[model samples]
Target chain A: MKRYFWLASYPKSGNTWLRLFLESLSHEGATPDINAMAFSGGHAAVRDEFERLLDIESNDLTDEEITRARPRMYELEAQAANAPLLRKVHDAWELTPAGEPLFPIELTLGAIYLVRDPRDVAVSLAHHMRQSLDQAIERMSNPQAMMSMSKRFIPKQLPQRLTSWSGHVESWLEAPVGRLLLKYEDMLSDPEAHFGAAVRFLGIDADRDKIAAAVEAVAFERLRSEEKARGFVETPPGVEGFFRRGIAGGWRESLTPAQVTRIETDHAAVMRSLNYL
Target chain B: MQGDLTLCGWRVRSALALPDLLPWLGGDSPVDIDISFGAIPTPAEPPLYTLPHSTLWADGRFLLHLEQVGKFWVEKGRRIVLEPAEHADESELRTFLLGSVLGVLCHQRGLLPIHASAVRINGRAILIAGNSGVGKSTLAAALGARGHALVADDITAFDTPTAMLLPAFPMRKLSLDVLDRLALPHQGLIANRPGQPKFHVPAADGFAPAPLPPSAIYILHTDRLLKSCAIDRAAPAMAMALLDRMIYRRAVGMKIQPPPALFLGLSKLARIAPVYRLRRAEDPSLHRLDALAEQVEAHAAVTRPLLAGSGTE
Candidate 1:
């Protein structure tokens, strides 16, 4: 049985960038299309694939029912995969209503969790969700913050329960699946060391030269320029673009001091553990 | 109450009240399918396809185990055996029976079921196809509100021999936001299932009971960057591929060895009828719905004369 790994992170943490780097590694000598990346095609929250795999309509099922079905859904996906699969996930590590881990542990090879500073996340998340800075901060601190949980209309993707940023990091850290933690700030500071470590964790036999080539292939400047020339399909409807200022600590310039304090106070414990504080 | 019903041109004898289907008016015609309350038999061998609550056997049998609902066995496209759970909502039980089970039956009978919501405009059926929750129902409802009669919602089964699109249930499964968006009252509307915001809105005003020959197929494509609606006619090759993707329960349908007639029917349908890519903004505003309906109507009108002259049917 071919197991899968999750490129797991809260929204606006460098999940997409890391995924692009992996895509670049596989498709050497060419720039990977930002829209058609492997992980992008297989998001954990995509509703269509779930419905197809289970032979059931998701709209007919309640949120609780959908949650209960999710673990087995991934198991089926694992069985169907010809090679090791990688899925992008925004949902926090949690249990289904049946008390089973949502991403079946036996079918999971590991999770590459990308942790970004909550303060920075709030700044980037505001732009991504089209929310004000204050609203974004509140969502980051909200224990029940959920994406696509709207009962009014069915969003394209399934409901992703992203608890507060602190809770999100802790959940994945303590999950039963094998964990390879890579901080977003560290990746930006030293791409060679951090990204190379990630490739090795995935059991890929790549030297530093290949890893550096993949990293250089997806530099933030190239990605931003690419999004400018040809619009990115993943960009939200009203958002200007997805690759907005792919730099760390933008909160210093973009966020109000009070806003920073809010994220800090809410997530200080987790931040201190990760040496963020 | 026993349900002696007709669904998509089949005589159905059901134990549950499948109110969505019309009464079986073909008095003496032998029942084509049976839906009974009974024990669901387990498959003798390992399932060909297995999910959390459902499994499909190699012999073309399907079993669905809905938590707190019931266990369902759909076998040979002729019989459906259901064992209702304690206090299971009848409407909930009927919902899956009509949807997933019926879709499997369509495949078994060698019919082409497209994942679409279709409406009859200018005396012919126009299928609006897309993935789930792409506003297929909402768009069909909008067209229906514009005096077009609804042919089907969700699953539009195409009968290959007659080259006609058999209408499914005369009901639109709409979410609360859609009801609010269309200003439809949900006061007496029954939710498809308990705890789900979707309601089963009966299409009594102008429900097309008889199968209508399909005239055009519109595949809904929403792009965030797109500012307005753009309808483009797809080439023959692309149309065939896109229409294949629109097959209802396509994954499950693949488990069944489809007859050669299914492909031949699809090819003929694609060759004659126009398949259009109806591109619209991902976040279409209120007025966009009306504009979309107008564009579709105008396009259908323009193509009618051309189709009449071709004599391809």
Candidate 2:
């Protein structure tokens, strides 16, 4: 079996940028229909895949039932042979009841973890959820509320949100897997360099020119425009767009005076470490 | 002599020949064992004139120092020699030591190791868990700077029996870049063999013994431009999702055979503690922490009475 590579991140922490860059590098020829891919939240593709395999609607089956019926589904999806199977998961690693990982850990050939400044993340999340930076920080500080909101908004398969900004990243950094840590600032500063490094780490071989072309092809602006035009939106059920503004450091302008101080106090060390504050 | 000892229902082989490694053997008992591989060092006693190997045992752990060799063990009366190689090229030995020594200790104690930064806010314990670089330490430090007690950083031990989160040994190793960002006082950086920048902070100023009752659990998510900060209750499914991400999921899974029961318990806990998704922009304002602290305190007060009756199965 070809090992799968997981592109993991906290929501809105430059995961899409890393994904697009990797997809560009791994592109053999022709743009594969992204709609056909299986994602954590969007149900259309999963339903279609299930119906095609078992001749049944997905809503009728529980997640357990789907797991039992997954082998056939996998076989059916494999018919579209040209594209490598790419799975996007937001869940953290945990073992199944059978003492096995919910997903196959051994099949995880590699992983790419993208980290961003939490202060910036807060700013972006505020805009995405239509909340103020102070409000976002306040909600985050309250572990109970954070858990409540996550239960309301995030999916069941995904991992629970950590109470602190730093706790979120530490989970993946300490995972027992080979992962390449990609900084969003570094990727934004020089997409070519970081993207190429990520591609190389994934064991994909492409010349510098090819990598450069791919990097240029998947610009953030291009993706945003593509998302807008194609209506390629995958927001949480009660939430908004997965892709908000693709710019960096918007928190400076977006956060209120009180919110800025709160975020600084909450994420002072992290912001300082990343030079965001 | 070799004997079989049952620990947590797992039968482990114990041999007397490996005396140096005996002190570290952990069980649910308080008995302390001591041994010596060669010359035994005593208090007020000079160094052994020509000792070949020495082993010291105290408390419940043992230390072995070999003159020409390093630490070694005899599994079954068969002498095993140990050689010390060059340190890791990119990571700190202290991290490894903590992970190995304390990690084993906690595992033996039926405690789960969690990847989180813990601190006390207004007498309530708050745990921050996320992937690396999500600003856990930064947030913990920020809260610490604001008078919240620092219980532990990077690793937290969840004491299942006590239904409390215990503080592991404290070692705050902040990067220089982080120090510069926070503008906090710190000693100079210590150059490990691989030359990674590690600065030390006083563990005494922040360390707290005994676990605090958990008040809230927040799953921190970042965004480029969040509109506002608000506290909302997490749905049962969402609560399950978040709990699934916790490091203790495996242990919990083992305990709760049918996962739905676990999810339901998490949902109840969610009800008892307010859970929220903290969203913000890339360059958010600094005062956000104050807002967060206020929200947390308010929520904790309301939930404390309700949570008092909630029991862990």
Candidate 3:
């Protein structure tokens, strides 16, 4: 009985465009392989996926001993899952440092979070971190803004604290008690009714021609012509693409009214409760 | 049980206490391996549980478990037991029993170990295969700061009927961001766990303790859009499929497989040494590893391996 969700976001919120519509839901006429998004399940800040789920290498631990060994490495990555995995967390709903609950909400079976518009996620997090739009709106209003904290090397993920874009969407929309939230401008104006209510909030029961063919099999002009014909190994090495401009209010044509008033006066009360004041 | 200690090139006899390693002083000693921490359990259960941190059942005896660290049972690979977990700590259960229970007991004694890192330049063995932060112990600590030796870390293993390249512990777990990006000096290192910024560095002098064979193998790939530094050479059918996917915990390397004469001795070690790839430029720039150790000491002085074509053909 392996099931775990969390696609949770805040780094250019739309979390890989809602993880390419949950990796094209349950494909029918096959358009899936947007570079093998075959049921995505990859990052939740990877430090070599908790040193491959505990064969252990955590580059000598401490980030609070790797968040107290991440709730038993997400409960043995949800009992070594056979089917439902999802993953992709951009860190924020944090806790462990001798506190607890750094995602072991009893082996979660829910979470999709997704949020956006911290002024179009500080212009797609300053072009997926190449940086600038006033340093990505001063690191989305830094509250100790982290992400691969790099002390020079050893950073293949697992440092992403990102506590500020309104405490990363109120820490995964106020954690615990199953979540689904979704709103990268409502999956860019109805990705078949917000990814078909996140595939019936993970119960999955579709309609409307298989949720409009898993929303035209993850369209954003076919993930920018498949990352302009294969280059995007999660891009961002002097970035040119990670599917940019998947349009949400172009931060009023590229923010600069002092970076859109420092992302609307430092995310004015979570952008006026997500209405983007 | 706090007695005998040799590491990665095992003779290990333990009950725990694997401090910064370094004890097994060479002499091709007859196999010993033994390690014990107490009553183990997990020697069966394995119906494809797909890795949540540990689980290997393998037919004739493998049983790896490893959840909160401990449950090892390496029966046919010459024995290892470890049970741990009751406040488990001896440098984090000997760092997951020296990586995937010493690379599944060096693939149950036939040894083809791989997930590499090696050095010994002049007397051969260059190696260095990748994929776990692809810097193979910061290029084997910049080829042991250019005096070259270091020979093996994170599982190199080979030595069966002298396919050579064995030697393993001289210390190099790294990651205090590769000792401040190779400016080195961590002063008698050793923090590989206890609030880990990963230390275990040690090697004030080249440490190749013996076993040689390899003459060139490369395969690294840091590439943040690789804009300089390339290295190439691989095709011999991609160096026999990157030595059948760089073995070490090669996901239960097919339950310690290595027979069929170890795939005809790794395709006669890909026609006796030569498998390049290399990449670079995920730039944290320590003079771009002084141009990747001057292109790996000019490709280990032009692909060594010719002490009269070191027999494989």
Give the best candidate by DockQ.
Answer: 1
Better of 1 and 3 by TM-score: 1
Which stretches of model 2 miss by more than 4 angstroms? A3-83, A87-277, B1-84, B88-91, B100-104, B189-194, B197-200, B225-231, B248-274, B283-306, B309-313
The prediction achieving the highest TM-score against the true structure is: 1
In angstroms, give how far residue B221 of model 1 lies from its true place.
2.4
lDDT of 2 by residue, B218-306 (tens): 65554433443555556656755765554432332222223454344445545454455554422223446545555545554564423
Clashes of each: 0, 86, 2
Residue-by-residue lDDT tens digits, candidate 3, A232-254? 56775667888877888888887
lDDT of 3 by residue, B1-313 (tens): 3556666566776777776566665566874788776776643455443454445554546666544545667767777877776665677777767777778777777777788888888887788887677778787787787788787776788764666777877777877656776687777665655555666766636787767888888888776555667888888888888776666666565545745656666777667788888888776555577678877888788775633334535
Distance from true location, Cα of A9 in model 1, Å: 0.6
Alpha-carbon DockQ of candidate 2 = 0.03
Looking at model 1, residue A249 earns an lDDT score of: 86
Best candidate per lDDT, number? 1
Question: TM-scores across all candidates?
Answer: 0.92, 0.43, 0.34
Model-by-model DockQ, in order = 0.59, 0.03, 0.10
> Residue by residue across A1-277, what tens digits does model 1's lDDT show?
6988898999999998888898888776257787778633568988988887777888888788888889878888788789888899999999988999999888889999999988889989999989999999999889998998766778899888999899899999999889899999999999989989889888877777788888998899999998998888888877888999999888899988888888889898999999889
TM-scores of the candidates, chain A only: 0.97, 0.69, 0.34
Give candidate 3's TM-score.
0.34
Which pairs clash in model 3?
Answer: A53-B53, A60-B196
Candidate numbers, best lDDT first, in rank order: 1, 3, 2
Lowest-sum lDDT 10-residue window in model 3 chain B: B43-52
